[model samples]
Target: MGYGITLQVSGDYALFTRPEMKGERVSYDVMTPSAARGILEAILWKPAIKWIVDRITVLNRIDFESIRRNEVGSKIPPRNVTAAMGGAHVDLHQYPSEDRQQRASLVLRNVAYLIDAHFEMNPSKVGETDTPEKFYNMFLRRARQGQCFHNPYLGCREFAARFQLIDHTEQRLASHYADIEEMDLGWMLWDIEYGEERGKGKTMYSFQPKFYRTMMRNGVIEVSREVGL
Candidate 1:
């Protein structure tokens, strides 16, 4: 069976349990669309169904610290690796062809800014009551205004610098890998359901590492630097 994975924004999330840092790393889910389309293709075998993504929901916008402490370990490599390669380690076990394709999926490599104006809740006046409906609405509003930029071959740090999103302090957020299972993003959910099919042939996919290579060159040279090699 042919396959493809896509990511979409889910909803707004509070970055931290504490008040001051609550809105820090706030971002979106970025997930795969519905299975209905894929299912239809499986049943009907239609070529036209190829390369279609269903939807993108905004799960939550969380704090940067949480992203670092939680996701960095597993999602990325150790500091030594980063220092040596200027990116995550490359696992040679992946499907070289698929790995190459993923490098071009802008959505996967791009850095997305949590558009605070659309997603962050307005501070309540002195003694106003808050409700779930109000909170959910806030997320929806932010989803409408959410924005992201894709750097097909660049790491998070370089991508952020190129786009002027943050100074060095926020630089780590680009490569920090955290445990996003609780967030219910496509990667986490699919891992639980399909047992991580992507990893079946390889220990890990190659997108992140390839992105690293692109970043190290200061955005000058890319994997596909040659005209059509």
Candidate 2:
């Protein structure tokens, strides 16, 4: 799964506009120490800016079964499917774990779907031939740069309080973070309540890449990167 960030700037911030997001506020979620340094330099950002994540949106939820089904009777040869399972079993742990590149390729194809869902890009262009490819490529390039947004809001699920118009389907995002310190580069942290008797522990953190792998395994996100990994 993927998440998005929106910032409500105070004194000074990495104030910029995402062209793709239609002039919405852009706050880069620094994934690495180097990228963090870059942001510090680019915006002359200081720790004193009262910098806090404004909001985060988990972008995609991939699953394995959906992917398997899409390939049921496709005309093209399945690039990664080694053995066809006839209503058998699907286990994601059986796949490679270390190479995020391979997993990224698979996850990015459906990124356009998430982008469309969140940004609401014109759907009329999906069949324009170059449109889908361009949309896919744009997100791929951004992720490769280790770029992401940090949301300071309570979490994706509770963020609707700030929205004037809310769509339940869009609320599919799992709230990952409760506060600002949980912010990390490209890593979206939110809160989740499991049972009526909420368990107690040092709150767990869920990584997006891993979530994406799960999604790929579950078939929520349809794109697959089987070759370059």
Q: Where does the lowest 10-residue lDDT sum fall in candidate 1?
A: 207-216
lDDT of 2 at 140: 41
Per-residue error at 167 for model 2, in Å? 25
What shift in Å separates residue 1 of candidate 2 from its native position after superposition?
12
Tens digits of per-residue lDDT for model 1, 43-130: 2222222323322222223233223321221223354554656565555243444433211112222223211111122344312555
What does candidate 1 score in Cα RMSD to the true structure?
Answer: 21.9
In terms of lDDT, which candidate is strongest?
Answer: 1
lDDT of 2: 0.25
The TM-score obtained by model 2 is 0.17
Per-residue lDDT for 107-155 in model 2, tens only?
Answer: 1111111111212234443343534345434434544453334321111
